[model samples]
Target: MEIKIIVDAMGGDFAPKEIVLGAIKALKKDRNLKIILVGDEKLINPLLEQESSDLNVEVVHTDQFITMEESPKAAIKEKSKASINLAMQLLAENQGDALVSAGSTGATILSAAKFLPVIPGIERSALATVLPTARLHPGNHGISLLIDVGATLHCTAKQLVHFAYMGSYYVSHVLEIPRPRVALLNNGTEETKGGEVLVKTYRYLKEAPNLNFIGNIEGTDILKGTADVIVTEGFVGNIVLKTLEGASEILKHAGRYAYRKRLTWKVGLALLSSGVRQLKKRTDYSEYGGAPILGFKKLVIKAHGRSNAKAIANAIGVARQSVEQNIAEHIGDSIIEFNKQHRLDFIDI
Candidate 1:
């Protein structure tokens, strides 16, 4: 089967240059893949022509695109011809099996929520991402899934509970883990922590069937791999994700500055080269591709805006794998069963 991936070619820090290159890389990596890049045809053709010969890639022309400065809702409403919205519409219309974008997180989320319906019984969607952890769980290879990393900004008790199940199923299906451990991110390890909303979320998760609810974990437990899945409201989860990103950036900047300024610093860095390589292997966002916007009818990968060719290629690969695995159907089936078991039309917010 030919797996078609539609990418928002105009939606990133590097636009057609990096996006086109990345699409070429992915197209080359898999012969059964077809890539559709949505952007200015003129700008994209030049970059794409420089790469693969006899490629199965297509360019969907559109000069319009949402900018980082524009509000997601307003831009999406006004810019009906924007690349991001067009790309999403293509996915909604079954033009592609999956969609990938290294664009504004808010824009992607808003656009996706607008064009793609949520899975049956899933009250809300989440931005689910993986983080490398210190403790390696058997079969997991040292990473944990964290959900709602800025998709909704805020969530109700039921919404947070829904996130836990989505995260659990995503890890299970995508990572091939069986009965993955799920936890609530809280101020304390106690079930009573994190105010009333979180407490209620904790209760719901704990009682969820077919889920390995491992109780609450604190922030320090994040990198420790305390659980395979960690659930938090988007506001808190996004902060945690950003904090890790900032920390990694700072370390890299400091290393470069020290290496240039002092011979002694250079020598120290050289001595720690092995450890640093391992750190990069674990913490590098490029290696993980991008985060999945869970709960949508179709798969959507939200790559980092600063993504380069390598990262975008990886994101495309991830989207392809998700399609092959039929991840959306799997999650949808689970939600349907859960609703049937509870005899409820929807989880109350």
Candidate 2:
């Protein structure tokens, strides 16, 4: 299948430059891929001209640009022609199979919800990202999916169970896992631990026939790959994500410092450079490209606002793989089945 990715070229901190460069790189790799660059035509055309070879790429000019400082709802209302908005529009219209943006997360979520909307029976779309884990368990060598990483702040037990259903389907389809284990992030292993919401969610998941509920998984268990899918409210998940990013940055800086200290350290660095690079790649979100706004009617990928060309390219790759995996359809079916079997009133918000 020919995958078409619509990009918000003027969305991020570095506008058309990073977006355009990423498109060029993706075009070089996949001849069947088509990219629709949505942004200021004048600015983008010149950048494209500078490149020696332009592959399967096209431009869709839009006048409005949504700034990071602007409110998401307000921007969606006023700037219908904004790059992010237009990108969503193109996806809704079936002009592109998937949409990618290094723009405001709020704006991307709001606009995508407005235009493409969430799948039927989906409470809200959640942002799902991958985390590196030990290779001893299921979903170990590759990556584990964490949902609602700063999307829906307040969630009910039913909503969290739904998150597990969607997240598990994603891991199974995209990551190629047969039966992904789903675990709720909590303080302890006992079912009695955590807040009332988590406790209730645990009970619900425990009875879910489709899901492989592994009870509660502590923070320490995350790196051990105890579960293939980790479900949590956006608030806690976001904190975990930021903490990991900060720790990775600190480690990189320490490695740099060690490399500059002495001849022996330099020799050690030389020997460990490849291993360190592999570790960095494993921990890096950019390597996975972007996180999918799962449960949406259309495929909407939210890239890092500060991502470079390689990150954007990787996100496009993710978008393609998501479509191929039929992630949206799988999530939709799972949610429908889950909702029918379980009573919605059981989970009081």
Whole-model alpha-carbon lDDT for candidate 2 = 0.86
What stretches of model 2 exceed 4 Å from their correct place?
A: 50-54, 136-139, 261-267, 344-349
Candidates' RMSD to native:
2.0, 2.2
lDDT of 1 at 341: 68
lDDT of 2 by residue, 133-204 (tens): 878764465678888798788788878988898888877876777789888999999999998898889888
lDDT of 1 at 46: 85
Residue-level lDDT tens digits of model 1 in 1-349: 9999999999999987898899998998899999999999989998877865799988899999998888989999999989999999999999999999998989999999999987887888999998998864454558889998988788887778778778887788777668889989999999898887888778777777888998999998898877899998888999999898898889889999999999999999999999999988888888888999999989999998988999999999989989998888888777776667655523453
lDDT of 1: 0.88
